[model samples]
Target: MKPPLDLDQLQTFITIADTGSFTRAAEEVHRTQSAVSMQMRRLEERIGKPLFEKEGRSNRLTEEGERLLSYARRLLYLNRETLAAFDDQRLEGTIRIGTPDDYADRFLPEIMARFSRSNPRVELTVVCEPTPGLVDQIKRGQLDIALVTHNDARGQSEVVRREPLLWVGSVNHATHEQEVLPMAFGRPTCVWRRAACDVLDGMNREYRILFTSFSATVITAAVLSGLAISVLPECALRPGMRVLGEADGFGPLPDCRIGLMRGQTDQPEIVDALARHIAESLDNISVPALDDATGLGFGAQALGRGRRGTATILPGW
Candidate 1:
């Protein structure tokens, strides 16, 4: 009988599937692209089938690969469960995680779930606040760690993800075509709000803030209801909303960076483990920040030439 398929190899396969790029998979697995290719070759030899085939610009999975995917995911889940079941450490601690609601909805599920499953005794406390607020909480030692967005390029931040801030409007309404663009944004201190207004002001664009709320959902509702167009991360663009572009004549929305910030308190081993899980959960994300070619493809003309759809696989980021 052939040797059993390796769990790590299966994970690599899943990462490639999740990321849709070998380079990204390599980054996820902390290996070289050549190493991933070699693993694929080994996996193919064991199964007597080719798993991947080259497609236009991307290496798409072959039919055989697709068939293997469902099995691989099941096997990996079982493997993790088995390990967790056997782990004797039985870690117990409290983890106070802070994140903006936008990110809380997009990114924390897998990290929290896995951490909870492995360390059943660990109590988790999640606080949903704006990025600036989260950072403040961390600074005050009120939060164990926080995921936040800022223009901080110094040693103070470890970038976990980058996303484009696009001009978003409702699909049925052409709210962006008005003489003076009406905007719905978060609080004045919001990084995206600051970036959007600065860019519009610098370009001398006529605009007004029709609504302001700290809640992204509310801002999204405003856009979806045709109340006003707003600046939002690509991840925040729901189905009913359309992305505005240079062709639309609106000023550019600057990209945002999400970073992992440590608190002032000393981190315990459990906290370190949780941090590792957070990093691993967000690995290999392909966030093309505002590249017209394959980025959001917001423009009509840009959408015509192959659509480079946004990656929602990073889950909640």
Candidate 2:
């Protein structure tokens, strides 16, 4: 019989794969980076296959790595389910979560503020990253839950909020209907890039990648500086930023979903309560009524509908 795999190693491998950095994985798992590396090496040896290809600071899972993903997920899920089934203690433990800097900047603080107030006993850790990183982190059990930009359907997550991605630029930028449009984008792996590129490809629109970075702030800065125009969630647009009238050749991008995800669906009370609270708050948020009198650009529409304190975001803007 094959020697049973160690749960610790499985979890370490998953975390490293999900975070894409040994340093980040070690912090998530509360282990040293060297220790995490050692565990992964042992895991690869035991399985007799290389799980990940190390290139620079980033790591991509090999085919063997992908094959082991489901097993790791199942193992982690079963372990959490079993623990939650038998434990009868009051809800207490740190639940680390990942969120995008854009969402964290504009939306999450208010919701998390409320969550902290209600559950004084539960510790919540929020890691800010781009959407793809957030999704991978959740899948690997690095994050208990995440608020992220929705992309391709991920079997491991549940959508709690869905919102449109909008096109924005500086007011001074020129519009071009005939030439390749310039764009400022997040990293290559970002959902926004995929969404933007897919639409551009479908419409056969010519375009050029003007600028790209992992930092939302950098992208926003580039757009704000008139370096290049960009498409982003409407909520991210700010004063001095201009909303380019929708890309003329493309249909609306799908609403991006953001919500809770864990290796195990069965969650402890604290985690479940936090998820419910976030979902309910998201649903209940009310946008302030728009001013019919003002004929502002597409950017202003978002703020007009956003109530200072309300829930249930409507489509449009």
Candidate 3:
């Protein structure tokens, strides 16, 4: 029989995959670069397949590596759960988690449900704010973990989910047909707002911001009321919204990236558990599909091109 895979080696492999560099993974895992390389070599030998291949200046996971990653994450997660189950003392504490209001409605329910079931004794304090506010809270160590819309200029974060950013308008309103396109958007600092304005400027399209708010509810209200159009990620889509694409004269925007930020905390174990649950929940989220009756051929095509090819769009505002 083939020998069992080493848990430590699997962990190192996952670290490399996450960090996208042996050097960075070495620092994260507290091992020398050469030692990290040796572990990967043995891991590859055990699997009898090359897990990674050189791509330009970086390493890209091979097909086999991609196949192993899912198994690796599951194995490590189960290992952690098994160890935690036997501990004499049950985990108990309050963990403060922050997320932008845009993601709160869609993401929090699943995450809260899963984490609470596993760690019933743990108390959760959820703070809903914009990404910038969440980042500030993390910096102040007021939060244990934060889910933010990843923006490189803002700071570094571990990105967990990515989806196409789309232009959306009310299905009942001909908002996009307006000569000077009325719009709803987030505050000036929002990355989606910046991307939308930049794209519109590049296209020489005239537009005016009719409404502005950090709350998704406000933006969705504007769109649903047929007051304006807006930009949004796939996961935030709501009913009565129709996606506007190149056919509608709006240019494509960059993909939206969701990231996690960790703050200084005394309860590392609880934080880690919550972080893992957050990542897993985000991964399992399926985007809702657009209604075919909306006659948004372009938007429907765009949705089909996403990672899961299933979901609607809500304005990022």
Candidate 4:
């Protein structure tokens, strides 16, 4: 049988030992110094030994207290691990998803592959569209979820990730100011194109639209040939591209939102599993700063092949 534990006493003991001062321990645990002193006294009594010895204004753990410190950390760590284990098993549902073309190219493939391995039964239907198109599809209930670039997600979907949009051009191109730049993007329904235009408009900058295509490949190809510059997500800066400048301080663009849209009733078990897997997978990815490039060859080789009708796995879907 396990011995009875006074958790409060044990916690107080650990806190005081860690901080090496009653006053500091009290501050850390958000308790009054007098209360902390009383808790420590009670802990000593329960253990039937002196846990600390006072020297001047500070405290030091006695030999017994030192021994107990190891046990305390193990206990707290085990408690958290146990809680996480239970939660990990509780999530299960099919999450039909739509997202922007760039997101599919940059980050979704690895995430999807990992998700498939972890939750094989989850039927994931991922549609690659421009950000605005994805948002529209979700609103119309054609998609159960969408990952879009909308700031605030106000009156819309849930924002999952926020990062700055940046200016990118082909390495071969000499970048001009916004006024003289030739631009490439998806069709008019693209939020990134809108954001870029909005910025240029506000700055009273004149620019020309060189190409429009839903395919990231087309836009990238055009940009690579020095036909245009584009405002793109930081992650989209591959080796062939160069950052001309930081984003022209547009109002916060919509974050990459992974919204749990209403009215999805596929295989509940499968949907839930996929959603959980996605959430977990995304959490593990570290979004790097715009200054340091994540490099190309991630999807460029396969994507650059110019072959259509190939089966591909997208991320947010």
Q: By lDDT, who's the top model here?
A: 3
| Every model: Cα RMSD to truth | 7.1, 15.8, 3.7, 12.5
lDDT of 3 by residue, 228-261 (tens): 9898876666668788888889888998888999
The lDDT values for all models are 0.72, 0.65, 0.82, 0.59
Name the candidate, 2 or 3, with the larger lDDT value.
Answer: 3
lDDT for position 156 in model 1: 74
lDDT of 1 by residue, 1-317 (tens): 75799888899998998688999999999999999999989888987999999888788889999789768866776676578678887667788999877777777876787777777888989999877677778778899888777557322767766666677777778888888988988887777777888988998889999988886667877888888977766555555777787888876665656688888655477777687667656552223545444224463233322212243311122
Report the Cα lDDT for residue 71, model 1.
Answer: 80
Who is ahead in lDDT, 1 or 2? 1
lDDT of 2 by residue, 1-317 (tens): 89899999999987887689889999999999899999999999999999999788799889899779757856765575466556566466778867766666666766686566555557888898766677777777787777765555644467666555656666655543437878877777766677877887887888899887776667767776777767765445455566554544544665545656654434566667677666645654444443333212354454333212322111111
- The candidate 1 region of ten consecutive residues with least summed lDDT is 306-315
Better model by lDDT: candidate 2 vs candidate 4: 2
Q: After superposition, how far is residue 55 of candidate 2 from its true place, in Å?
A: 53
TM-score rank order: 3, 1, 2, 4
Candidate 3: C-alpha lDDT? 0.82
- Candidate 4 lDDT over 1-317, as tens digits, reads 74765667677777787578888889888899999888888777877888899888889989898777656655654454355455656334456777666666655775687665555545678898766566667667787665565533423654444444555666655655445778887677556677778877877677889888777677777767778877655445556666553343323333223343332555556555455444444444443222234223322332222111122212121
Which residue runs does candidate 2 get wrong by more than 4 Å?
1-90, 175-178, 246-251, 265-267, 288-317
Best-fitting candidate, scored by TM-score: 3
